[model samples]
Target: MNALKHSLAGLAAALLLAGCGALPDKPARAALYDFGPGSTPTATAGAAAPRALPMIALAEVDANSRLDGTQLLYRLGYADSNELRPYGQSRWSQPPAQLLRQRLREALSAGHTVLGPEESATIARTEGRLPDTLRVTLEEFSQYFEAPDRSVGLVRVSATLTRSQPGGDKVLAQRSFTARKPAPTQDGPGGVKALAASSDAVVAELVAWVDAPR
Candidate 1:
């Protein structure tokens, strides 16, 4: 009987100890954002025909520290212009480089024959000559706030067109593109929407530029 009482006491003591640490509050869920589904641009009447450059390859996008990761980045006014920050509870579905490359491929495919890096490489192996290639480096992609309440999605990218040459690949043309669109709301979703619009706008202009006379 004494032994049974001792075992019960020990059980009670263990229960009391287990209850000492109040269950930690669950952490808030992280929000994941992306550009969502994008469609190929429709060909317009009287618009310049597709560029005669044949199939072009899209190299993996390059990015800096601010854009190299998956976290959604932002910045304050001109005072904190150099201070880049990221949202703790918000993140992108993939790295910015990957997202940009996918968007670029989808958008450019409408008006041009765009092959991925692998595709271009395979063609070069068999055909002895690869087509032109478009290499883009994303300099910035983030939400910028002019004031506490006003914000916009800002994106900047530099693109270069290269083609096969006797010695090696030759750069045909290169330029930088920047876009700023007012955010509908001062949150990640707003920034995402605005950025997507800005991206499409840039893609449209780039496609036209490629087909334009040099």
Candidate 2:
């Protein structure tokens, strides 16, 4: 009986080893993504240098609660467009708002001296002049799937330009901007590319609008 008991224990140990060996490997870590390095200026052999606009302060970009996390989100427009879903294996390197702010700062710097709110305030106290301020609110940002195979990255935002005055801040202008770019493929990676492209397009429009006569 003791020998039989030992034999049963040995068999149980062998089965346990086999079961452990057959278990599937651990799932892969989620992939991280961000807006790619922004566009580089190319020299036109004889093109005149672009004139810089007046210095401006950019407030932190704000977004709705839906975009407060780093999830790569999407909507199935064909089914329930209002329901947002996140990709399980992909995520943004930073929250969408931070990413947008970084991109905006980079683009705006090309045409003007970009300052933070604090920096602008310090300058105002010392120099007696306040730079114009740009405040952006991200309204909508997600990949929308028209079908299982067709999708586009969509972005929408509102911009407010204001100037400090002796009494209060004066609103210079307010405008809404939106852009959409079709995904090359209907997957997380493709959605990232499409969103980046849409962001660039929107930023280009915003820059033009900001520099336009007000």
| Best TM-score among the predictions, by candidate number | 2
Candidate 1, residues 1-214, lDDT tens digits: the string is 9999999999999998888766677899889988887763677989886544567788898998768788888888655977788878888999978887888887677666888888888888998877888888899888888887888888888989888877988989999998898999987778787787777777777777776666
Candidate lDDT scores, in order, read 0.82, 0.93
- Any idea what lDDT model 1 has? 0.82
The TM-score obtained by model 1 is 0.81
Each model's backbone clash number: 0, 0
Residue 83 in model 2: shift from native, Å? 0.6
Identify the leading candidate in terms of lDDT.
Answer: 2
Candidate 2: misplaced stretches above 4 Å? Answer: 1-17, 42-47
Number of backbone clashes in candidate 2: 0
